[model samples]
Target: MSNIIARFHKIQVQDGVKVWYREAGAAGNPTILLLHGFPTSSNMFRNLIPLLAEHFHIIAPDLPGFGFTETPENYTFSFDSLCESIGYLLDTLRIEKFAIYIFDYGSPVGFRLALKFPSRITGIVTQNGNAYEEGLDDRFWGPLKKYWKSYQSDPVFVQSLIPYLQDPANVIRQYHDGVADIESVDPAAYTLDIALIQRSGQADIQLRLFFDYQNNIKLYPAFQRFLRDSKIPVLVAWGANDTIFSVAGAEAYRKDVDDLKVVYYDTGHFALETHVVAIAEEIISMLAENQGY
Candidate 1:
């Protein structure tokens, strides 16, 4: 794992915000950008990137306020800001087009990019990237809804959830509940992620951003419109055990895209960790089928 982290190149995106990302395979090869969700960083793809690198050029970046990226105090942690920042990162890398691996928060960010530049998106592979109404309702929804409604008035109460973000036991439970096969996960990976979460004020930013999530949820229809109008191919690689988003979210993609494929894995929210090999192969096959590898 240390060896994998060593290969990553830390690049600075817009506003001198240092974005930590890893690139592998040849530059001319088809690009696959892997975007991670809440509280996790590019570290989510540490085990998966190396495997996919063999087939395609892979780029995984720690989104602004997460992982090694420096989140300035003045920076607005809204979804629009995040989406714009990612567009800047792609421009900096000179990647004209790429497919995306979207998970959790990655769905909103990645979809925003696709909507902004429809011609730039070649394909999409999603793992629990919720887009359905049912996916929005969960055990966590009750608290998140309350917080979203009164975040400005009760900022400290919002901050109190930070402890759960730091708790290894709680984090592990999140993984276990989302993933189908828990044995495949490395305990050390969770430890490192927890350390990253605690190293900076990432937890605080995440809480603040939680209140702003409604801004992104409102854009879901626009994303669906993009999918319906565009001809880009899409694949849904879902973790059947995901308790947070549920399987209904996977089915929603079928409604918009003409060419939609579904691959259900026996894991939870972090399914890529357990099904990296198969997922990597699926990504390669999807690209080859679409781009003529």
Candidate 2:
């Protein structure tokens, strides 16, 4: 497929957030809203967007506190707020109906949007985006779980975790871990992420979002209900070796979504780093099969 050039734009949302997004392809085609995960922004779609753009209009937005997107200091950095900003962006773009590609942090934001605007979401593409309890890997989440348990009573503990969470090494590990060939992973992706996270006040914003993640776990049931009830076509193109969200999470969708298609890649958390072409092909096939969605 011919590469389509992505254009960058920024729009101030209703909540005073300036959302930075990349757009490509013809507006008349089917739309794909790409919501990226933690530590990474719309830049994650840099490779995949062009491939998908051949068939669909692509909108990849950097969530607040992440990329070039500017968020007011007063703006609450929770998943709900993120969804609100994204929803407002969609409204501003006049996107009434579109498919959502959810990853990591994007899962909660996308799921919340699905819950609020059930009729608007045409389908879902989850890439390491967990909505199942079984998907949480205790090995990685153990400390976070402990922090969540003591969130109300222990300010000291939460403050102490700042170092580990904000460590550049950990950010690098997110892309390197679980992949067999480290050379295949691009340093630019994680390097850009590290630079962004090192910015003033960005760590605090990320920590705040981490604290708010407990609520996302609590809402899993509701997300599942929407999946079960809506019967929306879902494509689970996940990284099977991802230690953050296990393969079981990908399988769990079968229980809720009737029109589910699961494709597992051999890479790690950031599957697109190594498998963008295959993932894009899978997305095209899924869209072709569920054109009515």
Candidate 3:
């Protein structure tokens, strides 16, 4: 498995931001673009990508400010900017149509790419990526919501959250949030996140994305509209116990897409960490059953 995973590389997008990506699979096969969520990177997909590579081309790029992507000193960390950089990378690769695998923060960035090129998205796989208002539960998003409302005038909110995310206990909780066997989860998951966050100004950028998340919420209707109208192949596989993006958010995609294939995993926020085998199978199956799959 280690030998199969493509070595990571960096590319400068239109904005001059260096995007680090893990690309694998056959060049002629259907392409799968894996977009990561907050506090993690494409490394999270290390286990799943190779399994799918035998069937399709896979590209998992670290969004600017996270993972190996070099966080520019003054780069804008908004979702729009993140999408723009990815969009540029796609163009540079000459990729016109591909399937998008979105999770958490990847939802907004991937959804934006879908909107930008509605016809280009052959399909979409949403793994705990929420686009409906119902997905906004109280437990995890509550405090972040407060931070969003107050960060403009209250520096205290940002001051508190930055360290809270860096704290070892809280960071570990993110990895074990919905896992049934917390002990089985690797320590590397949280430790890797911590090492990256401590990189000079990484914490500040993470907080920026946490605040900008509200803007993604504002675009929920548009994202839903894209889903409803495009009606492309959409698979919703969610971690049932995730407190951050709840199971309700996972089911809400049905309002716009009636034929959506929704599956609930007995896990938490980072479902892939524990359910990679099942999740990979679902994605591979969906791509085959649906058109352009």
Q: What is the C-alpha RMSD of each candidate to the true structure, in Å?
A: 2.5, 1.2, 1.6
Residue-level lDDT tens digits of model 2 in 46-73: 9999998878999999999889999887
User: Between candidates 2 and 3, which one is better according to TM-score?
Assistant: 2
Model 1 Cα lDDT, one tens digit per residue, 1-293: 11232257777776667778878777888899999987688888877877777567788888988877765678888888888888888999999989999999899999999988899998988888876676774675677888787777987767777786677777777677765447778777677777777765667677767878877778888888988998788889988888778888888888898988899988887887788888877887888765686
State the displacement of the C-alpha of residue 228, model 2, in Å, after optimal TM-score superposition: 0.8
lDDT digits (tens) for residues 38-136 of candidate 3:
778888898898889888889999988889887567788899999999999999888888999999999999999999999999888999899988898
lDDT by candidate, in order shown = 0.80, 0.91, 0.87
Runs in model 2 lying further than 4 Å from the true structure: none
The positional error of residue 45 in candidate 1, measured at the CA in angstroms, is: 1.0
| Candidate ranking (lDDT, best to worst) | 2, 3, 1
CA error at residue 271 for candidate 3, angstroms: 0.8
Clashes of each: 6, 0, 2
Runs in model 1 deviating more than 4 A are: 1-6, 154-156, 178-181
The residue pairs in collision within model 3 are: 178-268, 287-293
| lDDT of candidate 2 at residue 94, scale 0 to 100 | 97
| Sort order, TM-score high to low | 2, 3, 1
